[model samples]
Target: MQRPAYGQSPPLHHPVPQHVSTVPQLRSPPPPIPQQQHQQQAHGYDGSPYQQQPMGAGPSHNVFGQYGNFMNDPAAQLASQFSQTAFKQGTQYLEQNVNRYVNVSALKHYFNVTNSYVINKLFLVIFPWRHKPWSRKQTVGPNGQEGWYLPPRDDINSPDMYIPVMSLVTYILLSTLIAGLRGQFQPELLGYTASKALGVVVLELVGLKLGCYFLSISNESQLLDLVAYSGYKFVGVIGTISLAEIVNKGKGTGGWFGWSVFLYMFLANSLFLMRSLKYVLLPDNHGDARGPMQTGDTRAKRNQRTQFLFIYSYVVQFAFMWFLSRP
Candidate 1:
């Protein structure tokens, strides 16, 4: 092509045109697509065939559906079932083992005492000279059987482990306090004292069991009942030691004053035991209706049991109390 002169209005040159195709050309970039239609077609490049969906549809809609599918899976169902079975079996095993050695209901009864009952029982234990009836109150059961002892909350004569447990703990604490006051307190001394006190109680219990066995005593009283009765001596021992200490002005539990106080407590405790145990050792005598007539051998055996009871109440109590009261 020849260049046009600058002065002359550039000669209009006809531009060479390329071959036109049948497809129509876009004007102004095909007028920009509507925003809604553009959004609808936005997923075109995801390599998936476009399908019309509801306006608000999104990934969030499938969340619960996926979860439901997972829950319906056999593996998940089986795992859930296994966990429930394991929990139930573990619960049953624990309950069985717990029920084996421990009498949960009986323990509840022993502790089911009222404050009034406790106070009255304490008074009776301390002073039995005035109180008349020593036998425990009996009730008729649903099965029409008599001789069902009333709960401690209802009867003062009902044996309860509550007082015994409290008194034993108190005794140990008081002993620790006494040791502290006497400048004999040691950390290990607490354990030693508790062990010694418990050991003495065990020995007394064993001795009583042996006596019961040899004397052919009825097994109406449970083992815990015997423990409760034997533990009464601790109350007297506590009184004796405490009074002796006070009398000696925290100096020591020695001298005639201490001995006199101890002797009084020992005698009081012995009397309490004698009265309390009378009902247990001689149940046939306490009932409203007299039992079957006894043969000579039975009478002789009863007399022997009576003698054994006296010796145990006085002699054994005296010996144990004297040993325990030592500062």
Candidate 2:
């Protein structure tokens, strides 16, 4: 055969060298660049594999579907399962033990600030109002003339009347006694209130104990229950007595009023016990007036009736409050 011209390609009809055909077989489409490679190339380079995929497949499909399979691989699945298990366990532990994290010492501080706190400094200023004469005396003058006058014994400032020590002590004693006495009677509603009051005390104690054990707080005072229960009685009795007076004034009679007073008095007392907080809060505006019973004044005698009226009014108010505080 004649030699080919210099630099001329071989004839198209001529058979190609076996090596050229073998080279194409060796290339073999490169096993379609593994999914990971496509992912890397799609993200790492300017061109996107999403653009090359079928039109029906969205961009998210190309990015996630290709890689999501590996994320769900056996080893990855096991790691994910372990992570979920640990997370659930941690959450459950926190839920079951969160009470331990509560700061119950704060509750004690709140209680001290709210109940039985003797702020004598502020009280010293307010106590004077109790001494001011609530009522004045009047009598017929000589020669059939009417005259208004102060009582012969007008000592409006009496330490004993305003101090409230006796009232507090008496209230506490009477409350305990009445609660004990009445508890045996098993009156339907009154007994219910008493039982619930006991339950509240128990729950408070339980909370206190748990708080102490887990949170390192302490609540060792037994008087807390006493004061709490006493407060209830104080309010309940005061309210009941007041309501009885109002009822007696309007629609009630002797025996009816007396029994009504007895029945409602427990409600008033319960209110007092429930709202022990009232002992601590007071008005800031108090003038330096004379005491409840001043030196040598019979105003106390005339005003004693008024005081009794006030006591009864307070009883009615206390009963209402107790009813509201239930549950």
Candidate 3:
């Protein structure tokens, strides 16, 4: 090595270059992140041990495959068993008790009705259009189709026992809410609610049964028929009380809503009874079915009697409801 000038740096020495290795490096590529890991990161969830394995494996390879079946699901098994047991019990109870009381054919027929028919009747009870096709006829066929021989009218027999019961329950619930709003809630009222409503139902059934007996129609009617028919006023009662609740709700009494619904209830109930009771009240003339046709005079008389009976029945029902539904 020669010495450079005073300002110049010393010469650099290059080391011998290392020989290039002919063999490739054995290091593996970093494993790609799994889709599950990405999902867990995005959702901020710890990847569960249950979901660690890839899906759609053969039964032989999958350890959790048997658990995939519905029978192996704890929650699904519990719900299915509970529902089945409840349904079986309910069906048994209905068959034992309710079936013996009511006409089975009639009950099944009523149950077969569509939701549209019931909803339409509910709407029409307010509007009551009196036109062709829409107009309700009070007359039954000469063969007394109103009897068990034919199905009851859709508009007349809609909802049956279910509506009455559900409406009464809803009424009690709403009344409880109203009472709570007024700071008058009492758990004791719940007991009285069931008893009083049930008492009213029993009273109405007895009253209607007595009336039918007096009218000589008891032979043709079952006790549960009166029960069903009498319970129908609860529908109007529920509607009226609901309107009153929406209006009164801790305030003063319903101003327009109360009176308006009351009036409508009266009219609707009367009209409903008119259509529903016509068959029972005014059966076709016995002679017309076999011998000669009924005279117009007799027909008119029956119609008049039916009209009077309807007015009397609905007015009585309205009065009973007025007293029963008072808050």
Best by lDDT: 1
Candidate ranking (lDDT, best to worst): 1, 3, 2
The collision pairs in model 1 are none
**Candidate 2, residues 125-218: lDDT per residue as tens digits?**
2232332332323455456554322221231211111223233344334434444544533335455655554554455445434432442222
Per-residue lDDT of candidate 3, residues 1-327 (tens digit): 677989998878988658658657889876457976777655444556665544443354445666567577898899989999999999989888976866685566445545676666566555554612422233465775642332334544433555555667876787777777788989988777767788888877666666655545423434544565666677777778777777776453357778788778877776766665554555545522212223553655655666557655666777777865677
Q: Name the top TM-score candidate.
A: 1
Off by over 4 Å in 3: 1-99, 102-105, 129-159, 219-222, 252-257, 286-311
lDDT of 1 by residue, 1-327 (tens): 888787888768887658558558787654445864666555433234665555435564568778889999999999999999999999989878988977677677788899999999888877777887777777886798876778999998888888888888888999999999878899998887789789889998898888877776655445667888888888888888898898899865689988888888888888888887766665474372212223333778788878888998899999988888886
The segments of candidate 2 whose C-alpha lies over 4 angstroms from its true place after superposition are 1-102, 113-176, 179-191, 196-327
Clashing pairs in 3: none
Lowest-sum lDDT 10-residue window in model 1:
288-297
Give the TM-score ranking, best first: 1, 3, 2
RMSD of each: 11.2, 25.7, 8.8
Q: Report lDDT (Cα) of residue 156, candidate 1.
A: 89
TM per prediction:
0.69, 0.20, 0.58
Alpha-carbon shift of residue 71 in model 2 (angstroms): 58
lDDT of 3: 0.62
- Which model, 2 or 3, shows the larger lDDT? 3
| Preferred candidate (TM-score higher): 2 or 3 | 3
Local lDDT at 187 for model 1: 96
